[model samples]
Target: MNKLSGHHHISMLTKNGKRNNDFYTKILGLRRVKKTVNQDSPSMYHLFYGDLTGAAGTELTFFEMPVAGRTVRGTNAITRIGLLVPSYASLQYWKERFQQEEVKHSDITTYAGRDALFFEDHEGLRMVLLNHHGHEVPAHWQSWDGNEIPEEHRILGMGTVEITVRYLQRTVNLLKNLFGYTVVTESEKEAVLQSIAGEVFGEIVVKELEGPSEKPGRGSIHHLALRVASVEDLQEWDAKIKEQGFDSTGVVDRYYFQSLYFRDRNGILFEMATDGPGFTVDSAVEDLGKKLDLPPFLEEKRAEIEAILEPLE
Candidate 1:
């Protein structure tokens, strides 16, 4: 009965690395924890943004693929990503800021028993901010001097994410058997699952479609990662995922952590990632996101790789 702690992060495809960096880091006030290239494709950038420490649950990563098409908002894809704010006061601050910035948003809604504010990023990626009542905000994330957003107001982590699927039972089963989640509640249109460790919650909703099924596109979720306790637990789950007949890529080193990825029945990519040796592994706590870092394996190619990446600011 190995269960995931909760979400590690969600990866999204962005149009420009620098622009995405500015929005998440500058406007959204997340810390740019890492600046590196995708291991599979060195020509593209893989940027990570999160709390100051880049802790397990508080991260959102991106694959810079400027030429990709906009994500179509229907059927068999992640619909929205929700981030946890510290309190109701913080939510009010964000509401005012969003209005001041002229960002389109919806009125606060009560979903799954939490107060939530929904909005979109520059690329139209739907996001929600919620007041997470029971969770403690990690000490290292109390203030981010970078975005001038105080630590008291930083994002707690992902609250819940929506996955719209056509085949509901299969997707629900995979989440339970493979990821160690328990069904908390369900409606005719949606099912909500709580993680084993209960650090965060998630939703898998069913959306009926009329014609052909849609493919995962840009601005759509690239993958959702489930946090494992350690590398050993990750390997154990790797075998389990294979036994369940899902083809998973065996452990791949992500510098900050290790990960194994496979697509779910509906083609949404899912990753099981370890929770250790975080961003502080290569850099000091005070120096994270201050400069680009190359993993030992990529160090030799740094000069060439840096040349291909468009400068951020």
Candidate 2:
């Protein structure tokens, strides 16, 4: 059976689109690669942030919902999102930069034998930056104002995503048996799963939660997306999910890619998406995210969408 290579992108909920865009672009120094609306709700913007080209593993996207209430943390929710920096010096640089910018962050600390800095976004979304040891990913974007961050200290891509669950075995089994992940490390409170070949993107950390189930709202993860090699692999996984007695979206084309959505044992949403027809499909590399680009099906309703969405900065 074909298995997921790694994470494609992580989609989270945010209260405002412009604030979300500024935080990722100006504050974090990431590139805003796509400006589109949520597929289900054409009124709300779905903003995508990533490396220079918005590579698969580097993407962090959000669905804007201004009126959504704050999320209540509990069991079975993604607790933190990790971004990879190049070195220990990079971590120190970030610490100093956060202090200078007044971004809420913790002092540098060690986790899993690497230096890290924990911080929260303007909307109180938990995040961490870890040392990635200089893994080369496509390209990275410079600051919009031309005051560029040094290449070495810039974010590499997505790191380990942390999730809280009531029980780990069910989730563990699904990851291993269905998703083709192998447990690389485990402890009483946490277990880390990665691809058998040891690629970085699908590295997931599951922590046992002692509290009640989580409530979804602003600042909660809408879904975690994993990558499949092709559309054929996606179709196979869709059938596999149904055969395993889980309800799945089957196959839905998202213009840039094909996708299938399902909930894991703990009720956290999981998306399996193909890794092709990327963001560049709709917009030029230099001009991506400059204007809203709708899928062909939604093209007819472009005026309606523009009317509904507030201009993102």
Predicted candidate 1 versus true structure: per-residue lDDT over 205-271, tens digit per residue: 3333333455545666788887787888888888988998989899999878999999888877888
Any runs in candidate 2 off by more than 4 Å, and if so which?
Answer: 136-147
TM-score of candidate 1 relative to the true fold: 0.92
TM-score on alpha carbons, each prediction: 0.92, 0.95
Pairs that clash in candidate 2? none
TM-score of 2: 0.95
What are the per-residue Cα lDDT tens digits for candidate 2 across 1-313?
5667778899999999988888888878888889998988889999998876677888899999989898888999888888888888999999998898889999899655557899998888988998876655433323233226777788778878888899887777788888878888888878889863464556888889787988888878878898888999899899988999989988999998899999988888899888788889989888987899898988999998898888877
- Candidate 1's C-alpha lDDT? 0.77
- Cα error, residue 56 of model 1, in Å, equals 0.6
- Residue 54, candidate 1: how far off, in angstroms? 0.6
Off by over 4 Å in 1: 137-143, 197-212
